[model samples]
Target: MKLYLQYFSMLVRCQMQYKFSFWMMVVGHFFMSFSLFFSIFFLFSRFGEVDGFTFPEILLCFAVVSMAFSSAECFARGFDVFPRLIKSGDLDRILLRPRSVIFQVLCSNIEFSRLGRFLQALLILIYAVLTSGFAWSFDKIIALFLMLTGGFVTFSALFILYAAFSFFTIDGLEFMNIFTDGAKEFGRYPFSVYGEGILKFLTFGIPLALFQYYPLLYLTGRSDRIGLIFLPLIGFLFLIPCYAFFRFGLRRYQSVGS
Candidate 1:
């Protein structure tokens, strides 16, 4: 933990060196996400409700997923840019460290710029909570915190999965964005609004809805199933397969030029 803090502190200092550039990147990130936020706003304006979900309910879902994703991007920025590390042989240096390879990989990069996106999501979350008409309770609040934790783990696993794939092909893969970025965009609404098929996929396959939809239903009083509130905990299990795949890929890593 101390080493992690030291590494994080170094990154903070590095980002501080170019204050203007850092602030510019933060602003750029905020606007980049603002476009998506506007799309949601326009959609809600036209339809009022989406598949039995109110605007505030959808906003809550969006806030959870967006904040989780942005937090993952912040901490797991190393995996997002793993291809560059491999290409530049920096990953080789990581392997030489007397620590777990995964740990080293995780510590490779830290993106402070993502804080802007996180702040935007947090603002949306505050708004959603205030306007969503859901009576707050202790259990409900715990569920909300669990949802955020679960979402972060799920998104972080996806980032790791993306990085693990780089071991086989040391280049950027745009297709993977369908799961990462696409989730952030389309996740503005509950997974069920996409239809039964997509909801099933998110529940059983990706388990995104486990964290976003089911718990959300309980929070919004759509369902009194206290059990559903804990469904997000299932997302932690998703990490098992992701880690297995990463282990498999690491064994196949050929050191770029070998």
Candidate 2:
């Protein structure tokens, strides 16, 4: 954790060295994400609620997923760019370092610019909370916190798994975006709204629904299942297999000889 902070601070200073470019990238991300919000806004304005979910409820869902995804992209961007290390033989240098390989990779890159999207999501979250119409309670608050934490963990794990795949392909796979970026976009509505098939896939296959949909049911009072409040914790469990897969990939890695 301490080393992570040092990396965080160093990166912040380095990025801040170019304040104009940094702020412009931040603003670009903010408005780019707002476009998706507008799409939802126009949809709600035209039809006024789809699948029995109110605009504010959808906003909450969108905000949580966007925040989680953006947070992951910001911090775990190293994994997203892992193919570069393999291609350039940077992994050789990384392996020689005394630190944990995962930690070194984690420290290799961080996208503070993605905070723009996070800020946009946070603003929408504040708005949704005010207009969601459900009475807030201690349990509800805890559920919300867990949803964010779980979603962050789940997305980060996906990044790691995506990185693992690069060991075989030696190039970044775009299809994985279906789970990372696609999840953020489609998650504007509860996963349940998609269909039972996708919902089950997300729940059992990817665990996206574990943090977003099930806990959302509890937040919206659709169900009082106390268990739903804690389902997001299941997302943390996803990290184990993802890390193991990364190690498996490491074993099979043959350097590109930079």
lDDT of 1 by residue, 146-244 (tens): 999999999888888888888888897888888898988888888887889999999999888989999998998988999988888888899899889
Residues 1-258 of candidate 2: C-alpha lDDT, one tens digit per residue:
998899889888998899999999999999999999999999999999988889999999999999999999998999999999899899999999899999989988899889899999999999999999889999999999999999999999999999999999999899998999889999999988789999999999999999999999999999999899899999999999999999999999998854
**How badly does each model clash, as a count of residue pairs?**
0, 0
**Per-candidate TM vs. native?**
0.96, 0.97
The ten-residue window of minimal lDDT in model 1 covers 249-258
Overall local distance difference test of candidate 2: 0.94
TM-score for predicted model 2 compared with the true structure: 0.97
Question: What C-alpha lDDT do the candidate models reach, one value each?
Answer: 0.89, 0.94
